[model samples]
Target: MPSDSDLVTVPARARTSTTTRVAKVLGLLVLAGLVISFPSLAPDSFILSVGVVIASYAVLATSWNFVGGFTGYISLGHAAYSGLGGYGTALLITRADVNPWLAMVAAGVLVAAFAVPVGIASLRVRGASFVIVSIALVLILLLVFQSWGSFTGGSNGIRLPRPFGDDVLRPEQHERFFYLHAALLAVLLLCWWAIDRSRFGMGLKAIREDEDKAQSLGVPTFTYKLVVFVISAFFTALGGGMYALWFGFLDPIFQFSILVGSYMVLMSLLGGIRSLFGPLLGAVIVGYAMEFFKAQYGDTQAHLIAMGALLAIVVLFMPDGIIPALRGLVNRFRPQAASIREVSAAELAEQRRAAEDTGGSERGEKEEVRR
Candidate 1:
């Protein structure tokens, strides 16, 4: 017969598992409903535009997390890939008259192709050296695009034809782009969740913990990092392409700016880089704050000042980011629950021996009675 403790623990374990599943399902449903209804609920075109920006940043931050968060590589040059995607989409649409949607996807493929060699070379380095390489990549792209005025429009920037043309009103334009960005964010989140539960994500986490140890365990650390880097570049590029379409403009200075890269890093770090939804939360906070600052202060340095202050506060008070900090608080204050204990090998062996003895005694008694 099972012990009293065993009976209690089993039911507790079952309840915990069931509770987790239900919570996840309900959370997903709530998120889906909010995203789908956001445009209609938005107060005005300006608010909707802000929503679009938040969604864009969310996508970029989430994409960055795949490599920076999961693989523990601090890549500050992701803006280069984003710029490449923007430029690729803009050039194709303006020069070749390709459909905007097709251009966006093709731009992602092009950026991924570009990432292959870069990842192979950069992934070999670690720490500061890798960071420098990443920064250099963005700088180089910025200069190249800035100088190639004939093809890239140089410092004057490239003006893109609107994806939906003049037929769409300003309000409708905001609504459409907001939904488009939301959809992209959904896709990226789905991909992140899928990878987070897979063996590949486990390998990435192993690399994050200790690359040498992971390599010794035959994790193929380089391949995994490179693959994830490429994937990150692809999605980030897509976000850039969409942004270019929405704004109908692309400037190398802004597109490939180190500031843009910093924002991505900041959003991820502020939200809890290790958590799946950390980047999204970070993006919402940072993105909306940015828009608010710009609206209040205009083109001055006020937004930058606010961002710096926010970063300092996060670093000082919530080093693990808001999500992780909040999670810790919840765990700390939540009521204690029963937990199942792990079985030891020695205990298992003893139980087996006892079962064998009981079986033998029963058999002997049966034989004796029969005789």
Candidate 2:
């Protein structure tokens, strides 16, 4: 006969496996439904445009997570690559007459090329120094673009021709852009999910947890960080290019702003940086909140104040971010419930055995007295 311990352990393992599978299937189904229905269900162009904005930010946040969340290298200068991508795509399309799609790809490639040297240089530093390097890079790019009036349109910024041209109605244009952004976000998420489960991702996490320990264990920490950094830059730039095409304008000030960089970091942190879907969740919350605040409060400081409050709340209450905190809560209760059931069963078993022993002892005493 199987021991009680074996019986309990086997069922627990089976239940956990079944639960995981069911959860994954349900999650995939929900995601599929959203992807297929969002555009059709959206009420108007305004909603679609907001969706596009959310998706764009999602892509940015997720891409940023490639390096920042996974590798624990909080880069404050990712805007440099994003801005370059915007300008690169804009220039290629406007000056060279390339297709917007091709221009987007080229822009990503260009950003990745640029990231090689930057990653090599920046990855040498740690923590605060790395952050400073990132900020400096973005600042330099902002200054260069702002000053170069002839080439990049300087303070005037550059106007971009819409990908679908002026013939498309505003509503349709927004709908198309919304889908495009969704596709980009989907791709980013898929890549993140893949990497999150990969050996390479394990190395990145190792670096995130302890770089020195990772290196001692033969993980090429520097190489891994730099590679992830370049990959992050590539996707970030693609998102920037898409934004440029969508908005039909690009401004150096807005593109390379510290605020944009901060938003990427904040979104990732607010959602749960360690999880694959953290950035997407964060983007939805932060993106919608920003839009709502701006629409309601106009150009006042109210939005900023609200954002600050939100940040403070997240930091104070959910230090590990919403998803992780919620997960932790769920895990805590789940185990307790299981333990309660097991304890009750064990208690019943003990009571039965004790009762039998007591009854037998009494009977034996009665028999002895009779004898």
Candidate 3:
């Protein structure tokens, strides 16, 4: 639950204007510009290392956005599925000398297969129980890794000989690693965009609001949820595979760690889980927060403490996340919700005039984001 201060229950209304859409696009551009410029500014290989970690995390957060963000499933074992992808790729590559790219694809398929059973079985649980199941599911994987250490590589886990062989690629490939993450982030963001605008997304909104009501209206609630569950697992595994390759090693504890899963959830929730831009914003904010905190308070546990406090603030004062909070502040000043929904310069004029003509009580002017 969002902290009480953050939980201002803004009544839902249609966005009858174009301002919000334009703002979203502009925000994306700014974020893209910043991401592209970061590696060049920091020559230190370690900062780039952190970027890789953030990138991999961004993928998981975005993928989880499909289920937890959009469908309200609140999956907590996302990292477990991702670990499956990493370990699966590692075993196939180390044991059989398979191509890394091919190994990732195979891992994705296997996880998607595993996801079907989990989805079908877990759909019976809803809300908090559903979230708990996700956590419990990770434990099941941990036990498997521990008890079957002989086959699964135990607690010490798998290792990789860099990309092809060298631990570090040629200097020419420094930005290549960065671009790989940028591209992966693009793919995940695009998937989120596509999913949010589709018919399935409408079903998800319905499910999010009230499952019984949505099912009563003839929505195939179970099938859509299961399909998204499997799809989310597939992408998450792909990310995990990339992550393993990026680090040149893998451990079950590192791959399947709850902290990774928790951070993904926190990032999504802190940025506005239901919004399309939420995961991206959340990832960037948290990523940079970690960097800044590490710089300021890396000596002790102060960084973690500071991070916890910031999260609490988000939960308390900005329950809708920073985007919504900022949007609300902007809307309070301009009240241009109707003028901004569809994103046209002249069309916006007509919208503003219409609002004025109606005595400025444009009840539907607020741009309510669909989940």
Candidate 4:
């Protein structure tokens, strides 16, 4: 008895709700399996190392998503905060002999301590100017790290003892680190996903679309930026700690290089910047590609050349990345898929419209007879 519009719209919400529920159940099962298997079984060395690297990168990339992707701030200075985080906690855990776990806490606090001051100063500059200033800060910090030869080991770089015992770790240690990386990644993703769907994420999106409009709407623009900056730096620091742990060393080039910054950007861009899976895809693709190139070409430089080529191809052909590329291809190749959705909606709307029109005519006839 409803209008076509009403019937169609009613079903739209119901269909969406059903689809979301089904997706959630399947996603949960996959996540549970990934988490549960790590403790029970052992992964090969190559697999374990690769997993740690990808998982760690995912954390960094996802953190970057908060401000970079969602808020429209393309940050090339992510390395500055991450390196500071590594050095901050690395110093505490190494020199002060704090627990590595506690060191990670110190890293966050320290990164945030610096982030607040820097963010306050940097937020004064908008858009391109702000980005430039942030990058300059990274260079300045890197110089500072280099200058403090006693603490940071200057150009030579400082080292951190692995959280593992003094004895050379057995195969089990690699698996444990793999699980740790996985666990860390899962926790970070869960947090990011929640934020991405929350009121905060909505506010951030508004700010990204139009900061002036968002600010006019009583969104605390400065506060949100500061909070996102600190939170992003926090996770980046955690990932930095993981990086240091994985390699058992930290070098200035590794920590502060433009390449590291580029890697973060590349991962986000290649994966599908806005989606949750985007960073993961970018990391997996880029990571595996490097290994593949290294094996095939027998030179590290091959990665750079291959990456540049791949990036060019992706930018030219699939700038939206693999996910969007695949979706577009599916829609193009099988027009019926999207047509099916539109058809269903249109059909329901048409049926409801007809029902309403018929009911109206009946009412009119009945009224005339009564009269």
Candidate 5:
């Protein structure tokens, strides 16, 4: 019943797919090895430190994507959760004498719990209204943290003990933290990848495409958004707590700044939020650029201007992000027949007409032969 060519093609396609998968796995393994050994490969401690910063940014950006990328809700005040995490971890370590690691975990949990009520209220709005609500949340936290100086150290900020302690050399500390941050990023990436393939992810994408339609289709849009919001807060807070431990300082002004949230949004947008590695790739590029600008310009606010320009360029040109843009370019040039999905309605109509003409011609020829 099957055509001979199709039978041959099926096995060939399967083999090709298997080969491609193996190649991908091998490539990833090599990349992971390189990442793990980056500290040793780096020429100096500064490079290692930069790696830590990039890794932290990747974590934060990926965490942000859990909500921003999935639900299509742009939160401009996500730094509030991160700020809470930083303060919570620092306060626990300094005031309660808790272990730094335990404090970080606790901070994340607390932040996730705090996100529930916030998400309930914030998720009620959409578009600019949601964005405004998010920004207000951050501003409110900023004011509260700044004013409550008696407890939070006020404008002076609080000093956190380095989790690795003074016994560890600076380079070693950087190396250790780099690995810690990288490990967290890997876990988050795996979670994201898993979610991307699940029904839950499909629901999130549906909501992203059309919330009202998603709700009408029996998807619980609010619950899905809320769950993702809390999950995002947890990871984001962990990133903040880790930074607090590594940097040995917690300034509410810096922690709760809207700029931090903006960076997360920008990085995700630059890298292509829908793809698994988009944020990570964006983080590396943006983080490196920021550091390079700061190093070149010193204490001047030149890096902010540079980043703003970069963000503007990304939004204007690569709106879907770099990965998707690159993918489109690749597909455009690839020598392959277009899939049915890619075929235009006009093309499909033309194809149907051609097929019908061919069938009619064959039938006419058969009739002529019978005559």
Candidate 6:
């Protein structure tokens, strides 16, 4: 039979876990409610349009997190997958005469299938080499699409027929796509939440901490990285396809721009890549700032400069990102979760003496029983 202390402690721990879970569920519900009500609350169509873009960025950032956040791969050309997804969807709709919605799904599947070989090759490298390979992928795709004038329209690019039809007003389209992007973000978040608590997530974190050590411990490091890489590509492609459908345009240069990939990286790093909502939080901040700068500065590179400054600030100060930094601050101030105090040599000695005395008493009691 267990001790009374054991019964008490176990129930306390269980109750803590349960309370944490309930709080998380309630928080998610509140967030979902806010997301659902965003368009209705927007002051204008332009604001609604910005909301759509923010939601889209949130989806892309979270998708990127599947690899970069979990496996610590830090891909610099995730735009390659998104570009491929957009082109695939466009081609399927134009050349194959598929329905736009169906084209998006088909494009996602095709892009995911393509990701397998790409992931296998990319996962062979690590660190800067992996980053270089990822960047090369987007560059290669960009040139390939650009040079294939007849098929891809070269620099001319291609335009998509809006999936929602011409009957929908621009503001209405923005509202609908905002919801669509939010739904996708919600799904990605749920998937990430599940993964974050699973054995697979543990393996990914092990890889992130030390890939060689993880492999030595039989974690199948390469396999785990590749799986996450592919999964990341899949969702990224879906986001790209959705964006293409909404925007009704696909310029290979813009679609595959290394800048887009950098945005995803920055967003994740800004918000706390390790946490479930880190990327989403980052997306909202980065996306709005980017859009705001662009709107205020016209076609100038002010947004780029702002982003660079933001990146520097994040790196220099909050290296752990906003969420973790805020968490640290909160923990610091919490009375019940007070910071641990250092013990002096005297204190250590006293603890040791107490433990030894307790052990001696236990032995004496046992001996007395034996007698």
- Per-model TM-score, in order, reads 0.87, 0.86, 0.80, 0.81, 0.88, 0.87
Model 2, span 1-371: residue lDDT tens = 33334333234456888998999789978976896688889998898888889988998999999998889888878888888999999999988999999999999999999999988887887788789889999999999999999999998999999889678998888788888888888899889889999999999999999988999999988889989999999999999999999988998999999878878988998998998889889999999999988888898988777777887787688757889988878877665643546456765566556656665676678789989
RMSD of 1: 6.5
What does the lDDT read for residue 332 in candidate 4? 78
Model 5 agreement with the true structure over 1-371: per-residue lDDT tens digits: 33323222233345867987997799789879989989999999999999999999898999999988888888878899888988999999999999999999999999999999988887877777778888999999999999998899987999998887689999999999999998999999999989889999999999999999999999988899989999999999999999888888988889999999999989999999898888998999999988888888896878778878988998898879999988789767754656656455775566556656665576678789989
lDDT ranking, high to low? 1, 5, 6, 2, 3, 4
Global CA lDDT of candidate 2, please?
A: 0.86
**How accurate locally is residue 170 in candidate 1, as Cα lDDT from 0 to 100?**
86
Tens-place lDDT per residue, model 4, 1-371, is: 44534433344556866986998789778866975674455346666666666667777777777677677777888888778778877788888999987897778778878788878887755688668866897788788888889878898998888788868564666677767777777787788789889888888878788999999999888788778877887888877876777677788877986667667777888887777777877887887776667668886676777777876777687666777776567557543533546567776666577657765686678789989
User: How well is each residue in 182-210 modelled by candidate 1, as lDDT tens digits?
Assistant: 88988998899898899999999999999
lDDT of each: 0.88, 0.86, 0.78, 0.75, 0.87, 0.87
Which residue segments of model 4 deviate by more than 4 Å? 1-9, 31-43, 167-170, 312-317, 327-371
Residue 344 C-alpha lDDT in model 5: 57
Tens-digit lDDT string for candidate 6 (33-115)? 99989998999999998999899899999999999889888998999988898999999998999998889888888988999
Candidate 3 Cα deviation (angstroms), residue 199: 1.0
Worst 10 residues of 6 by lDDT: 1-10
Cα RMSD of predicted structure 3: 9.5
lDDT at position 231, candidate 1 = 99
Mark the regions of model 6 whose C-alpha exceeds 4 Å error after superposition.
Answer: 1-22, 336-371
Relative to the true structure, candidate 1 reaches a TM of 0.87
Enumerate residue pairs that collide in model 1: none
